[model samples]
Target chain A: MSSTLRSFGAIPAQRLVRTLLLAMMALLAACGQSSEQVDDMVDFSPPSEGVSSAEKQPPASTGNALQVDVGGALAAAPALPPAASLDEVAEAANRTEPEPLSITIPGLDLNQVPVIASGVTATGEMEVPSPLEVGWYRYGPTPGEPGSAVLAGHIASEGVDGAFRYLERLKPGDQLSVAFNDGSVTNFVVDEVVDYAKSALPFDELFARSGTSQLALITCGGDFDAQARSYEDNLVVVASVVA
Target chain B: MKKFVSVFLGALLSVAFFVVPSSAQSDDARIHLIHGIPGVNVDVIVDGNVVFENFAFKDTQDLSSFAGQTLAGLKVNAAGTDTTAIDAGDVALPASGNYTVFAHLDADGAPALAVFENDTSTVAAGNGRLVVRHAAAAPAVDVKANGAVAFTNLANGQEAAADLAVGTISAEVVPTGADDPVVIGPADLPITEGNSLIVYATGSLDDGLEVITESIADLGPNPTVVNTGDSPIDAGVPVGAGLALVATALIGAGMIRRSQGITVDA
Candidate 1:
C-alpha cells in the first residue's frame, strides 16, 4: 500500500556480507580448513554462477558433526545406516512431508523467521504471510521435494517494514538456509529475481510439482497504489538447491 | 524378434515402476453420475452394488471414494427396484481421472448411457479448458460461450472442446439451426485456471433439457519424458552371434598356427 515506509529496519548489505564472511571463516576454521578458503567457499556471485557452480559441488551439509561425535563420555553409539547419495535423498524427499520451521538468508541479514502451512482464501487468493513470518502454500510441494516450493512473506505492512523488507534487494548467488522441524537444514543459492505485474504472475511456474527442485520466495514490490491499497507488482526470488 | 520382445517387456516394466500412482492421500478417481432420463427415477449400480437408490431425474451423485482402475459393471434400474433399464456393461475407471456418466434417452427414444471423458490436461498459465457433450435425445445443438459458438452442430453422444482465458463466462445451449431460443443459460460459469470444465446437455427437448456441470482440477503439465530411444538393433550383432564369429575366426587361425608348429597365446 502507498505509504512512507522505507527499509531502515534491515541490516546494510556490506554489514551482512562482512558478518557472513566472518561466520564462514569461523566454520571453515572449525572444519580443519584454512580461513583463507572462506573466499572460495562463500563467494557470492550472480544467480547464473550460483547455479553452474552448485552443479559442481556436493550437497551442502553444514551441521556440527564434531559436536555430535564428541558429545559425552566415550560410549559407542549404535551403528548408523549407510549414508544415502544426493539423488537418493532427493528421491526420498518425495515420500516424506518434512515440515519447515524457519528460513534464514545471509545475504539479506534475514534470520530464522517461523514458517507455517497456509491455504488460499475464499476469494481464491493465496494466503499472505503475517507481519514478521512467512507462509508456505500447503497444496504445493514442500522444500527438498522434486518441485517448486513456494514461500511468501510480507514486504511491508501498516507502514512498517515486515520480515521480507529487503527481499527486493537479494541478488543471484545469495545463500538461503531453511531449517526443518527435524533439525535438518537445506541450503540454496538464488538463481533468478523477477518482478511481475500483480495481474500476470506465473502461477504454474511457481507451483509446479514435478521438475527440478526449487524454492521461490515471493513478496509485494513495485510502486504502491493508494487507491488499490496494494503493490502493483510481485517480486519473486527463485533459488536452487546448493548441491 | 526374440530380442525385440525382451526389450519391449523391459521397457514396459521400467515404465510401470516410474508410474507409481500419485501418493497424495487423495489421488482417487472422482466420478459423477447424472440421471437425465425424463420422468423416471432410477437406481445406479456399479459392480453389482447399488450406490444410488431412488436417484431422481436431473439428480447427480458424486462417487468420491472410488479409486484406481477397475472393470466395473454399471447398470441403471427403475428407482428402488431391480428391473434393469440400461445396462452399460463393464467400464474401466482409471486413477486420477474425473468422469461423468449420463443416463438419458437416445435419438430413438430408448434408454441408454453416454460416458463423457473429461480432459484434465493442464492449460497454459491463466487459461482453462472447456468441453461440451451433447447427450440429449434432441438433434444437433450449438454451445455458445459469451454469445459466440464454441461448439457447433454437436449431435447426441458427441462432444467438442475449446480453451478459454480464465474468467467467468456466460454460456448457453442453442439449436444448431438458429442462435435464438437459448435453452440453457446466460449463466455465469467460472472457468478455473489449470482445470477442465465439462458441461453435459441431457434429457429431450420435449422433456425439458438441462445442463449438468462437472469439473476436474489440478491438471498440471506432465514432466519431461526421459528418452533413451535406443532400439535393440543398437546393441549391435547379438552378443552370442558375435562371440561365436570371433571364436570361429580364432579357431581357424589356431589351426593354421598349429599346423606350422607355431605357438599361439590362448
Candidate 2:
C-alpha cells in the first residue's frame, strides 16, 4: 500500500499546497458568479420528457380529416355528409347576407353615393345617415334579394343638404341602381312616392326581410319643428327590382 | 456537481418568472357542450384533439380548461373511439365570448350540429333574457311561457328571445295551431337576475325529447330599452294635430300588419 501511494507523495509540498489553493479559489469564483454565466458553462439538452412540443402540438387541419376508430383500427373519414350544401356554405362564409355598398339614382341626379350600414337609434327610430351619404338598414335585405331593403339619408344637417335630399322628386319609371360588396349591381324602377307622418312611418313594409325585392328611399320632409329637432313627416320613395 | 445545481436553479427561476405574465394574459373562450343525442356517449375534439371525453347524453359540460383560439373545426366522436358523430365544420370561436354547440337532428331527422351566436349582453336590474332555440327534429311549433304563446310558428333551427322578469319560468311547447297534447312539456325553469338563460329543445317527438337549459350570470349592464313599433306617441308626436296624428298612425300600423303578415313584438 505504501509503494502504491509513493507517486502521489512524490510532489513537492509547496507545489501541492499551491494546487489545492488554486482549486479552492476556482470554486469560490464559480459560486460568486451569476446563474446566467453558470448556464453558459453547462450543456442544456432538450428535456427527456416523453414527446417533443412539435409532436404534441399538431397544426389544425381543415374539413373532415378526422380519424374514426372502426373495429379497433383507425380510419380517416372521407368527409361529413353535406347539409344544404349551397345555402349553409354560403351562410357560413357570410356570403348570402348581402350588404349594400353604394346607391345611384339617375332621376334625382344622385350618383353612386356611399352607404353606411346603420341600425335603430337609441330612441328606436331609424338612424339617419351622414351628409351626402345614404344609410342602409342593416336589419333589412340586400337590394337584389327577395325583401324590402330600406335606405335613409339626412335631408339637411346643420343647413347642409344630404344625398337623398331630392329623393321625393323621383317618379315612376325612374331608374335607380345599387351596388353591393360582391360588385353586383341591382337595378330598380321607382313605383311611387308617399309622405308619412314621422309617428306613423310604416314599420313592416319599409323594412321587410322577405318577399319581392324592393327598395325604400327615405328622408325627412314636411314641417320642421325646432322644439322636436325633427321634421313632422318622412318622404319615402318605393321602388321595385326591375333588372 | 455545484455547477450543475446552479445552472438548474437559474433555469427554473427564469422559467418561473416568465410563466406568470404569459398565463395572466390568457383570454380563453367559454364553450358549453350539450350532449343532445339520445343514448350515445361522445368525445369533443377541437382542432384534431379530444377535449372532452365520454360525454354522455343530456349532460352539459362547460369547458373551463379550453383556452379560446380559432379552431379549424369542432368534431364530436364516439366515446373511447374515434368515430365522428357530428362535425360543425370550421366555425370561428370568438376570442372571449360564450357559445353553445348544439348536436341535434336536422329537418330531415339526421344528426347535425349548429353553432348559435349567443347574446350575452346584460339584462335589466330584475330581468333576465330567455332565448328559446327550436333545434328539435319536429315541425314548426309554438313556444309558451307560463302557458301563453310567446313565440308563434317557430321552425326548426330558428331562435326567439325575450326579456322577462326574473322568476320561476314555466314553459311548454305545442304543435302549430293546436293547444292540447303538449309535445314538449309544462316544465319549470328558474331565471336569475342579470343573466341570460338559453333553452334548447332537442330530439324528435317520435324518438325522444330533451331540454338543455344553460344559464350564464353576471353579464354586464342592462341593455338600452327603446320603444319600437307603433307606440302611442306623446312627446315625439307632432303637436296641435292630435286627431289627425292618431288616424294616420292607426292607418299606417294597420297597413303594416296586413302587408308584412308577420307579428312584430311590441
Top TM-score prediction, candidate number: 1
Task: For residue A91, give model 2's deviation from the true position in Å.
Answer: 40
Candidate 2 lDDT, tens digit per residue, B8-97? 443333222212211221244566656667667788776466766676766665532232222334577888887887765433322234
Per-residue lDDT over A1-243 for candidate 2, one digit per residue giving the tens place of the 0 to 100 score? 122123234443344334323422332231222344323222121234212322343343110122121101111212122122122322332434556876767656554566788665434556655555678876557676777878887665544555665667788898788877655677888999998887677766677666778888887777766665667777888998885
What's the TM-score of each model vs. the native?
0.43, 0.38
Candidate 1 chain B, run of 10 with poorest lDDT: B225-234
What's the CA error at residue A67 for candidate 1, in Å? 56
Error of 2 at A182 (Å): 66
In terms of DockQ, the best-performing candidate is 2
| Cα lDDT, all candidates | 0.58, 0.57
lDDT of 2 at B10: 34
